[model samples]
Target: MYVATKGGERAIEAAHQWLAEERRGDRDVPELSIAQIREQMSLAVNRVMAEGSLYDPDLAALAIKQARGDLIEAIFLIRAYRTTLPRFGASLPVETGEMAITRRVSATFKDVPGGQVLGPTFDYTHRLLDFKLAAEGTTPEAQRKSADETPAPHILDLLDRDGLMEPLETSEDTPSDLTREPLEMPADRPLRLQALARGDEGFVLSLAYSTQRGYGRTHAFVGELRIGTCAVEMEIPELGFAVEIGEVELSECETVNQFTGSKTEPAQFTRGYGLVFGQNERKSISMSLVDRALRWEELGEDNTGAPAQDAEFVLYHCDNIQATGFLEHIKLPHYVDFQSELELIRRLRREAGAEEREAAE
Candidate 1:
């Protein structure tokens, strides 16, 4: 029997040093500064923040640099860091409608209230390789617009005013947090949103696109996608009222989908909602579509058994960190199990071959 080589302690220490050196890269090349990473590699930072369930862009940028821009590794860093932080009490839900607008756009409306401010988006930019970025040259920063002083009520709320849409109920129940608790089956909306917020962007996007292609089809329009800060208030039990704990920038998307009324009910527009960390408009929109699709049961629609319509399917598969980690970890030393399988298969084949020869004779 070949003995397995063992140098656990020394090897582990050596790996740590090597990782540090590799993360730093060539000493002469000059390191990519954290501020540079935060400003320039912000999209990568956004993904880490989104998946890691933490909103600190600077920390995310540092993690990205430390992980050599491998996003999964960066996510792991943030997750690890998040585990160390003390748990603060849950904050009161911020009225997202009152968010200090940074980026707001609605594709469905030509000119809506707060007037369609498309702040810092690459939507209209031609998809071309910019050679300047390879050498770090001057590219004009995305133009920013000052927001309007007074924002109007949500577009869907306007529909509600005319009795064309279903209005949201004022639920006073506290929402669940997925991070602290183990994800239970038959999750509530808060848990679903929490899962979707940290979900893989590509996976959620594909799920959203699937709904558009008629798998649990629902007519959806971007009612609004807004990115900005909302004051996170907390209920101080001693104070008998909620007080502002902190503020967080969030991306909120609301979609108006065509509604189907039951025999006793009048037809009204149904809506889907998504609110997530940071400036993730695409994720927010995708989440809204996915959210609506998951609500087929609540809406009294026939379950077509589509993957998007299946809460277990969408919720379980949405997170890249969980999916990637579990999928890729199989590459690690699984030799013991592999050898057992190999022996079992070999024995089975040998027995089958003997049986075949006897039968032929």
Candidate 2:
């Protein structure tokens, strides 16, 4: 006795019309231009680009406007649009060493080679609201410094000289793309990092926080966190050499974790790495912490059964789109299923009542 619900198409169309009207609240008010959003709401645009796995800021800004400033929806729009575009060839892996550094910091050492440049960070800012911003005004530009010509060497590289940090192996093996391929269980570090890079920022942040509260204690130190622009090089077949095709803003983080050494080997500090699109330092840091927590098994540490330590658990539930879809689907009509359950409950009650009457007789 199941009947499909009717008027779904008409209802959807009506809902979209209402949404469009709401999006343009008060026609007298000036509409937000794409260029305005791209400049003023650049942080929102950056988040959309980072999570969507795309680099086009202009497109991201347009998606934000189209979605009525809904970031998740903007990310979805960008992701959907990206799939339709043709891929010519894979670009070479970015060289972080050649990055034109903007912001760089290290918690392990106060004085590093890069001089701990705190560029455009809110770390020292007071949390109080700036009422001055309520009035229409232009921000004054701060004093500037001459750009440093020397490329700062990675802090981990210094530790590597003394063999204090675990040696990282360079491989020519290509990493798996989660978008193109199906995600398998017991995923490798590369796959886990890929999933985490595009994962929900808040979810990743909470999970990382949980580890610090002793769910999966990974005595971690911020080895180095850097934000900068790096050149994207692609190998030219005819020229037989790699050439810079473009440049992208990147946020990179490296965490130094406590080591677990065997009897045969000396104890050395383990490392966790995170690299993300745009200047998303919070996500990059969270990614590094979660990355380190997930590496417990490979590093010869026991599984503490922490949520962050479970690779399968973390990777499966981190996606906002998948989680949002499943969560929102509950709003759909389930009258037939509910009626069936109701019928079964009535039958069970009737049988029980009859048995009681017979026993009394």
For every candidate in turn, the CA RMSD to the true structure comes to: 2.3, 1.7
Candidate 1: regions farther than 4 A off? 134-144, 147-151, 238-240
Residue pairs clashing, model 2: none
Q: Tens digits of per-residue lDDT for model 2 on 174-252?
A: 9898877878988998999999999999999999999889999577899999988888999989999999999998899
Q: Candidate 1 on 1-361: residue-level lDDT in tens?
A: 2347599789989999998998888899978999999987767788789899998999999899888888888898898899999975877668888888888878677777667777878899898998888998787865565554355457677778889887785678877777777787898777888898898888999989999999875679998888888888889889999988677778899998987687655788788888878878888899999988988887788888778898888898887778888999998777788888989999999999999999999
Indicate the residue-level lDDT of 263 in model 2: 62
Alpha carbon lDDT of each predicted model: 0.83, 0.89
Instruction: Please tell me which predicted candidate would have the highest TM-score against the true structure.
Output: 2
Task: Write down the lDDT that model 2 would get.
Answer: 0.89
Scored by lDDT, the top model is 2
Q: TM-score for all predictions? A: 0.92, 0.95
